[model samples]
Target: MRTQVAIIGSGPSGLLLGQLLTNAGIENIVLDRVDRNYILGRIRAGVLEQGTVGLLDEAKAGKRMHAEGIVHEGTSLAFNGTHHRIDLKELTGGKTVTIYGQTEVTHDLMDRRSETGGATIYNAKNVQPHGYEGDRPYITYEMEGIEHRIDCDFIVGCDGYHGPSRASVPENAIKTYEKIYPFGWLGVLADVPPVSDELIYANHERGFALCSMRSHTRSRYYIQCPSSDKAEEWSDDGFWDELRRRLPKEQAESLITGASIEKSIAPLRSFVAEPMRFGRLFLAGDAAHIVPPTGAKGLNLAASDVHYLFEGLREFYGEGSSAGIDDYSRRALARVWKAVRFSWSMTMLLHRFPENGEFGQKIQEAELDYLVHSRAASAALAENYVGLPF
Candidate 1:
């Protein structure tokens, strides 16, 4: 079989790209190693930058998001036993973020794709891209004990960090940078009302804790712990008690607790692979970069990547210009690096580092104090939080 473009992975990035391409009269096929149910089962961050929301609208997948997603004008930062609010909308000239889960985003895109009858092959094993260096590129995969191949004009890898796309690249052709934090986030998803109207990020003597919500009745909370920690080690009561200890008195008193629907520990890391384009095979999303999730930039970064890639592909097919494709790496990386910096900065400012000792803790608190009190600093945070322009 053959197509104009062959896409790997069925995550939000791949589905969003496929939807955009289908709407543009471009033919593309999506392949994933897992089925749709497993893809949607993965729980991820939910904060949507205005730019991301616009992309969803562009893809015609924003209706349910606009209807069910909560729009937050600002987020709160709690430190030194006090709570401070950063006016994201006011600081960013009316730009705001939407609180829609990533799972919901993927579901919407999948539905849109199915409605349009786009091609997506799931549970294909050993998928690999070949002959991307020259004009011709194709993909090979195994399905149901049969071998198959697809010939396409280009290949896109949205299959995530461990997928075959990045792994297929020669070691010398790519350079990677990574920083693994000493701690990880132990998170819980509960069907309980949020303690605050907006998300709260707390920097306390104990650790860093985040209070986020998917909706009015569903709360997602995280507390920093050692990198070696496991989810089963902490009970619901223990998690709640530790979270309350990290917040201010007012929020702690108002906080509600319940049985957790999901619980896990995610290690914090900042990683990026240089030159997202490898000949005709371009990398997007987790296949190219990763952030600590402190500033909630993971999904937003992927959306920006798809935006750049879609525009490039559109130009190639619509105008017959190679400029966009040629510049995809440079363009995507420029924005990727900025987000990496913002996420790294937020991680440094909010999380407690035991290795840094008392001096580091004091410095972190001092920076947080200055960040909240200074309008310029606060605006900078708000701008990054709402997302940089695409």
Candidate 2:
């Protein structure tokens, strides 16, 4: 098979990229090692930046999102036994974030792609990109013990951190930077009304806790835990009790408890691989970088990468110029590093570090105090939260 572009991984990044390319009349094929149901089964955070919403709209996958997603004008920061709201819209000139689950986003994009008859090969085994360094690039995979090959003008690796896309790059040709946090997030999803209308990010003497929701009736909550903690160890009642202990007096008093529908523990880490493009092969989303979920930047960063990649491909095809593709790595990395910094800062500010001792605790308190009171600091947070210009 021959195509203009061959996409590795069918996650949101690859699916979104495929949709955009299809809309542009570009022929591309998506290859994934897993089936669609497996992809949908993976639970992820929702919080969509305004720019992400626009991309979904451009891909014709925002209908369900705009209809069902809740719009939050601001989010709250809790510390010192009280809540302080940061008006994201006011701070970012009418910008706001949409509370939608990443699962829903993927579902919408998948449906849109299916309706348009886009080519996506699921359960493709041993998928590999070859000859990316030269003018001719192609992908090889196996289906039901039958080998297949796809010749393409370019290859895009949206296959994520552990996928073959990044593994294919020679170690000497790529440099990676990573930091693993001392704690992980023990999260629960329950069908209960949220304690607050907007999300609350709390800093307590014990640890950090976040109050988020998938919808008005489905709440998603998380609390910092030891790096070795396991989800099965915590009971539903225990999780709720601990969460309440971390919040302010009023929110804790009104907080509703229920049986958890889903539970998991996710470790926090920040990782980035430099030079996203290698010859005719390019990396996007988790294939290139990862951020702790503290600032809710994971999915948003992936969308941004897709935005840059799509624009580059579009320019190359529409104008017959290689400038955009040539500059893709530099442009994507600039915004990526900013987000990595923001996520890292937020993680350091909220999480409890026993090793840092009392001095670290005091510094965090002072920074949070200044952030909530100072307009400039609040504006900066709001700007990054709503997302920077694409």
Candidate 3:
């Protein structure tokens, strides 16, 4: 198939790019290694930044989001058994993050794209980007073991952490930077009501816990855990007991009432690659960088990348100029790096590390204390949390 842009993966970045290009009257095809049923099959981030809300709104992806997404006033931070509320709207000039699950976002995008006159191929296998710098560089994939090809002007890689996009970039074409943490987040989704009024980030000597909601009936949260254990080994009772230990004792909060437990182990890591573009292929989203989810910047950063990249492509095509295209890599990296730092900071600060020296723990506590008491320090957290306006 021939297209102006060929997008890999159906995650937020790929879909958004397809939508944006479609709106711009640029033809594009989105290829994925999995079907729609498999694409929306996992549990993921639910929180959307205030700026994310605006961007989706402008792109018309916000109507369903605003209607279905749970809007929170702000989030809470707990330490020493006391909670400090950060009024997000007050701090960020009335910006609010939404508690809409990523699954919902994908479903909404899929429904819209179905009527959008765009290509969404699934179960695509053996996908390869070859013959760059040509009028018809293409991606090869197989569905049901039948090889197929997608011819295009450029290929956009939005594949997640473990996809083929990263490997496709030739050696020395990109510089890989990464930091892996000592701990990982154990996340869960329950049908029970949320334990608090807003999302709460707790700093416990035992570990860290996040109290967030998916809807009126579904609550989501996370706990810091050792990186070795798998969720399958954690029984239902074990999950609840772990929750009780992390949560404050005063509240009789328990996960029950037909709440099916789904757990995921999240490794805290920060990574970035120099020059997201390689010839006719451009890497965006996890194919480009990954931040720990503590800052809730993962999905938003991916969306931001596609936004800038889409604009650059449009400018290039319209003006027959390569300036915007040339600058796409640098411009995308600036916002992505900021988000990486934010995620890394949030992850390191809130979660306890066994390997942390006594002095390091003390230093961490001191910083947390300053964050709660100092307005300047708190505002910095608030801005990064609520997200920077792009």
Task: Estimate every model's Cα lDDT from 0 to 1.
Answer: 0.96, 0.96, 0.81
Give, for candidate 2, the lowest lDDT window spanning 10 residues.
Answer: 356-365
lDDT per residue as tens, model 3, 62-125: 6789888888877888776677888888887777888888888888777777887778898888
lDDT for each residue of candidate 2 in 1-390, tens digit (9 for 90 to 100) = 999999999989999999999999999999999999999999999999999999999999999999999999999999989999999999989999999999999999999999999999999999999999999999999999999999999999999999998899999999999999989999999999999999999998899999999999999999999989889999999999999999999999999999999999999999999999999999999999999999999999999999998999999999999998999999999999999999999999999999989889899989999999999999999999999898
Model 2, runs deviating above 4 Å: none
Cα lDDT for residue 267, candidate 2:
94
**What TM-score quantifies how close candidate 3 is to the native fold?**
0.95
- What's the C-alpha lDDT at position 4 in model 1? 97
Error of model 1, residue 291, in angstroms? 0.3
Model 1 lDDT tens row, 285-385 = 99999999899999999999999999999999999999999999999999999999999999999999888888999999899999999999999999999
Task: Point out the higher-scoring one by lDDT: 2 or 3.
Answer: 2
Q: Is candidate 2 or candidate 3 better by TM-score?
A: 2
